[model samples]
Target: MLGPNGAGKSSIYHSIIGLVKPTFGKIIIDGIDVTNIPTHQRCTKFGISWVPQYGGSWSDLTVYDNLVAIAELHIKSKEERLAKVNNLIRKFELQNVVNLKSKFLSGGQVRKLTLAMSMVKNTKILILDEPFAALDPQSVRMIQQIIVSLQMFEKISVSISDHSSRDLLSCVDNAMVLSEGKIVAKGTPPRSDKKY
Candidate 1:
């Protein structure tokens, strides 16, 4: 989703993620009506996961610890948690900062960690809200690359909400432009490859 500030993009995210219940209509996911589902159940049962604006993380915990903590909550097997954590660390390229406190990570690394953290629950759909905000150009580009990869290679469905149409469109295969809580435009990105 591409929308300017206060265009209700985040509000839409909240509704779908169960943070804010919809006043009407069904919030369906994976062919099931999830409007009545709780926030945790939306993720645990429907395979929907999200990273909010500014990214989600435990500031005091190390990068590795953050990944491990999420895995521990969602995965029951001891061996499964270890495997999932290890895969996320390698997938996000956080090997160098594994022991570093999340508060100390660079902007790009923190974004990487948050997205990785969301996947610990076997996320089928990843929703990112304003992921491009408050980052330097380099970090922005890095995140763009990661988003494209997550959809293309990792096979995760992604919906991103950002004011920067150019940046967000570049990372997505399809897009819906929102204005004042309404969808103004919906279509594929100009490029079919969607290579950022």
Candidate 2:
């Protein structure tokens, strides 16, 4: 579902997570219609998670604290929650900055942290907008590797939008292009159209 700026990708994400009600059409996950379900209820049932372009985490909180809170909220067992949060911190290479305030993180770090938080509950479906925005080349490559691993190992369904064709091609098997809030083309996107 990735596209260029102002392509309504965020809008679509919000609608799916129930933050913004759809003006039309149905949102179905796992063969169940959830268009009218409340956001919290949907979180519990469908394991749907979203990381918006401009929102996530408590800025004043340390990276570790923020993830701890998210893990507590989503995971039932105290031990399991702590284990998962620690695993993600290591997986995303956040140990160096785990105690730093989220506001102090570089854009790439924040994006990685946000992605980690979105997977706290092992969500089956994830919608991420601009997941690699403001990342350096190395950070981008690291995130790409994590995403590819998630796809192959977890079989999680992810819809991510990026301006770089390499980002999408590195992780996605399919692409859908949108214009003015409507789908214009649906097919395999190549590595050449990086801006789409």
Which one is best on lDDT? 1
| Residue pairs in clash, model 2 | 2-161
| Deviation in Å, model 2, residue 79 alpha carbon | 3.2
Candidate 2 lDDT trough over 10 residues, lowest sum: 187-196
All candidates: TM-score: 0.84, 0.90
Candidate 1 weakest ten by summed lDDT: 187-196
Question: What is each predicted model's overall lDDT from 0 to 1?
Answer: 0.84, 0.82
- Where in model 1 is the C-alpha error above 4 Å? 135-142
